[model samples]
Target: MSASSLKLRMMIVTALFAAIIGVLAQVTIPLPLVPITGQTLAIGLAATILGWRYGTLSILLYLALGAIGVPVFAQMSAGVGILFGPTGGYLFSFIPTALCIGLYLEKTSFNLKNAIIANIIGMFISLLLGTVWLKYIAELSWGAAFASGVAPFLIVGLIKAVLAAWIGIMVRQRLASANLLYA
Candidate 1:
């Protein structure tokens, strides 16, 4: 298929979203085991807007930027070494989480309900990776990891998922009306 000029726009928006994600992710609420932040919300929004390939690239870019000590990450630190930290799971998980959200929307309409379902599923993917990393990297037990890494964020996760879905639908509507999408 031919490339769309929208790629350029997507790149700009992706960068903006990455920065937003990084900034929003700063307010980490420490849990009994892991910490929670609004990073997933940014991931969801980026995926919905950028689609799979660019969305994944955007997250990877964010990670790479952080790795270079750009302070573009949640905790304002950077480098591959930070991957061993407590919140590392969520950071790594963002790539695949974004892929899932973007890929799903590529084939289907992104309604609020569908976006919610997609974001929930994507978040589950993120939580699974994050929790596993918490257990391994953080040297926590599985039970404890689940309790801390996943449990406390459940309610807020749901809320973020809903918000992501709603935001996706709204953006889609706006794009369609403005003829920003393929006409």
Candidate 2:
């Protein structure tokens, strides 16, 4: 592909992932603790398919859209305030999380075990960053932050990571076969 074509492909893929993440964020399952959202699954999908550079850019693009008064965040919330709010760390962490997952998958073959490992690492990074941010921003103790921000979502996050990995791998293979792997 030409340089312009590659750039266009990147733009399209980034926008597509941003939209996917936005749509997934709306599919929330209310829980007594932290509610489950599909954002992480979408993140995994984006990272695995797009690789580190484009994957992280996609997440950044999504955040930018949300920051620009687009209701793309969970519960349809938006604005720059959300980026600096108590939950902001979780949102910000999405960038690094996608980068880590994408980098790992790009270096290694996209197998189930590798995908699971990458997703788990990325998930932990997000939770850790989110917990720390919650602790500091919310004036909560470390234990409280971990309890509210990390502990509640551990199991579900793992499930989502695994599922996203599987689906991402399948979708990537299909795209590759169809000569539409966004190259």
25-55, model 2: which lDDT tens digit per residue? 9999875434678898999999987878888
- Candidate lDDT values, in order: 0.78, 0.87
The lDDT, on a scale of 0 to 1, for candidate 1 is 0.78
CA shift of 157, model 1, Å: 0.6
How far residue 168's Cα lies from its native spot in candidate 1, in Å, is 2.1
lDDT of 1 by residue, 1-183 (tens): 234666555566667777877777776776654567777888887777667777787788888888878886665667777766877888899999999998888778766767888899888999999999989877888998898788888888889888888886787578657655432
How does candidate 2 fare on TM-score? Answer: 0.93
lDDT of 1 at 156: 88
lDDT (C-alpha) at residue 118 in model 1: 86
